[model samples]
Target: MSHTQTIPTRSSINPADTWDLTPLYRDLDAFEAEFSDAESQVNDLSSYRGKISLSPETLLSYLKAKDKQFLIIDRLYSYAFQTSDEDTANTQTQAMKNKTLSLYNRFFASIAWESPEILTLTPEILSDWYTKEPELTNYRHYLEDTLRQKAHTLSPREEEILSLSADMSYGPQTVFNMFNNADLRFPSIDDGNGNTVEVTHGRFISLMENPNRQVRKDAFEALYHTYDSYKNTLAAMYSSNVKKELFYTKARSYTSTMEAHLDCSNIPTKVYAQLIDTVHAFLPSMYRYVALRKKLLGVDELHMYDVYTPIIRYDSPYIPFDTAKEMVLEGLAPLGEDYLSLLKEGFDNRWIDIYENKGKRSGAYSTCVYGHHPYVLLNYQGNLDNVFTLAHEMGHSLHSCYTNRHQTYINSNYNIFVAEIASTCNEYILISHLLKKAETREEKAYLLNHLMDQFKGTLFRQTMFAEFEKITHEKEAKGEPLTCDTLCSIYSDLNKTYFGPDMIIDEEISMEWARIPHFYTPFYVYQYATGLSAAIAFGSRILSGEPSALDDYKKFLSGGCSMDCMDLLKSCGVDMTTSGPTSEALKVFDRYLTELESLF
Candidate 1:
């Protein structure tokens, strides 16, 4: 039987299990009407085009109008995007999503003149205007941030051309999305019962953890074999993607693509550098973990396919969706009554789409339309990982809730730099609680092993990816063409270095670079490492009874771009500038390793 048989169509799924986009728009007609109105607002922006710097009054008025325009367009896009994700096969919803994006592209082209015009003013003049108009205080950070990029701000015509290119820039991502989700298909494999089962990206994870070594190897080989066939196409697509980054960085006169991407969040390039360095220094722990897995499984050699299967069978209880919610509530109790109450409100109000459905989006995400409560999308499977996913996504939802309540509309959206902290903190706290409540030695070992895996996947693997991106981007920065052979060689070497001598270092692993979507966004994966590190620091503090720790964390959540992301993290007591938090996180990982070894 096909595993997807258990998945339901959008119409067959229960209403309560899906999110209510009604909060965003009452109906499709409402969404259409807003789209029309937002287009009008975009046209209206022309009136303020060259007049943004005429006076403090003009700038403030333009900013307010811009905020209003964004609010409407974003809401329209959010509704359409979620509707399309509800069922990717729905052609009408997909058209709406496409139309919404087109409108955004037009809107972006319209406002492209605003930045360069604003840059026309001197920094001193902008500062003086801020004092002259106290209302600009609401957007002081936004204004100053704009000024900070003055050196990189292009001419008005060049900016307009770049803005127009935005729509086409998504070409590589669009191709990957279509291929990964819609076109790609995997062949069936034997289930050890003489039954053949079709493989899916989602089911591949479970198959890798199957006890039968042949089953795991078959799944791995089948999946990568499919990818290998398309390696040339994928390499070409990714090459174009990297060249686009190079184009933008060189166009804007930045030193490198990594610097350009990090500049958006005002994060120091050194943070990215140090994360890779620190993880490299501590890689022996990763090797040791791999060696232990090899010994426990009694396999002569550990292959890439064998890495995910648990050394100790968890035999964890089958947690239904509702029970998972209750467990999450209990696990997150340390975050205090107000945060808990808000979380409860989200659960009660249908803020989450809680299960997988055929043609629905494959993974999890939390998105907030500024006026409405935050929305979380999940493909809950009732496993331990799903339980933690519930807690993890709720972390994002509550962070949105807190920021929406505290910050202005413009400032309501937090930066990606600090976005992952709350979600990871929730996961850590939930796992910590689970470990404490584990009754048997096997259960405790399972939880500890899960923790170790989390460290491996998030910290070590992501850092390795971060390094790969750094190398590739730096290479391209020096005018090196990222051909298939070059990309594969660099990726293969890094995989071997990170996984150590124990792993079989399958040659197929080299093609892994063509598969990671985040590579489309250069330098984006390192945040997972930093986010996990910050979570360990923050979660440990609150759990260890550090006074006011929870409050400080809440403060960090409530701060939505009110300050720089790095500074906001510092307020929460984790510094990414140095290797301190990353070191502490690795120590935590080592402690869990020691515990898991002792349990054996």
Candidate 2:
């Protein structure tokens, strides 16, 4: 009989391997008590609805009360959702999560009049009121931001209707989440040894990294074929998500979904366009790298499955989790002792749920409540990429930790635009550190391959994803149908353009779009590209021991939503408005490619 590897159940995992949720709530009973109190607090917020602009005092009181209500609601939602994520198949926790979402919707509906009513207060009146109530100065930026959306602000009743429709709008994402995480299953394949291992969402990428080409090819085909079987349904789910964004875009009177999404962070549409244009200018560099990959692997054809495997062979492909942690700490030491101290704190405490369990959500993310510490979810497969993921998510967690400790609730949550910068900067630092510490030519080449892969994945690959989003969303906006064939065709063409003629664009790779969760959130993947550019800039400065580089970087992390994201990056001495950062980052990629080629 052959040995079969199976995912352990959640109950079977050691407590230390899981995140400690006790800070949010001691147990389900405590969560319910807070949930009940949150409902009453949300209802109480309705009492200030019509009187929002009556007086500055009334406005301040309402703002404070609303903030208080949200603090509780945030804790409740975080707890419920994290619990449900622990086991997506658990009906009880799913119900708990849904209940919190409903409470949030109710909270939104109750405060629907906030922006419109605030808009009624004239600039002079608000300025005068600010002096009368000095504390209102705290929300000056928040108030101005609301007023900035005056043209798009809907009527109170209409806003309430839209708020109530939140759950309906979220339906596609919810359904897709449940299907992808819980309902969908993949076939088992040989582990390239005598053992047979089951394919899973968490295991798919690890399988792709297998040294055996047959194993990589098998996992790729199996995973995509399963997704391909549900192509129509997945297409509909994606189409619905696009339509949902369109509905809100038109409702808010925005001309384009891209404009609408970018406007939330005050980012210019040209920033998006500039990224695409810049990446296009560097496609030859990407092609050169792809050719190098093909040459080194010495394969007749480079397929999508061949992309992830390490080009240079090195001992110990499997890094133990404990070793990964120490490596991350050492890699990030350049960020200073204070930063490392926090990373150590998270490690000592159960701030991370570190392994995959049956029915647990796939992939990794860092999330937090305002007053509590951040939590990270991971499906540790003991691969180098997983090690990078560990460092990546801890970057996010520590960013949140810094912002939460420094800013009030209103300003603590940074915009998604800047969110990736912190995460990717950590990755850049880690890769550089690994390269510097390499003991042999094989090790150096291996780390170089990993570094180049990071650039390929983050800069080139994410830009490709960004382009796909732009094309698909534009097509949908023009009333073209986003059927499975249309989407697959668009995605396939992008792969051809991005990977160049040297690489074979496999049919299974076309269905790759269906599996990307980021697509559900419009115009998001571009940040990964933009973020890499900014991160590389910052990483270079810090590694060179530039004066005030580390300090400026930490200040940016602590700034959160206190300033416009563009201004925040500008303060860190990286002006994202121009193409300098992206172009510079690609030059770094080119340099690495040259070094790697010389080694071979």
Which candidate has the top score in lDDT? 2
Instruction: Write the residue-wise lDDT of candidate 2 on 1-600 in tens digits.
Output: 689999999999999899999999999999999898888777787788889799999999999888888988989999999999999999999999999999988889888888889999878898999999999988887898888889999999999899989978889999999999999999999988878999999999888878899999999999999999999999999999999999999999999999999999999999999999999998998899899989989899999999999898788557888999999999999999999999999998999999999999999999988988899999999989999999999999999999998988888889899999999999999999999899999999999999989999999999999999999999989999999999999999999999998999999999999999999998999999999999999999999999999999998889889888899889879999999999999999999999998997
Write down the worst ten-residue block by lDDT for model 2: 312-321
* lDDT to native, each model: 0.86, 0.93
* lDDT at position 106, candidate 2: 89
Compared with the true structure, the alpha-carbon lDDT of candidate 1 equals 0.86
Q: How close is candidate 1 to the true structure, as a TM-score?
A: 0.97
**Regions of candidate 2 where Cα sits further than 4 Å from its true position:** none
Which ranges of candidate 1 are over 4 A from the true structure? 1-6, 193-195
Error of 1 at 100 (Å): 1.2
Q: What does candidate 1's lDDT look like per residue over 331-355, in tens digits?
A: 8888889988998898898999987
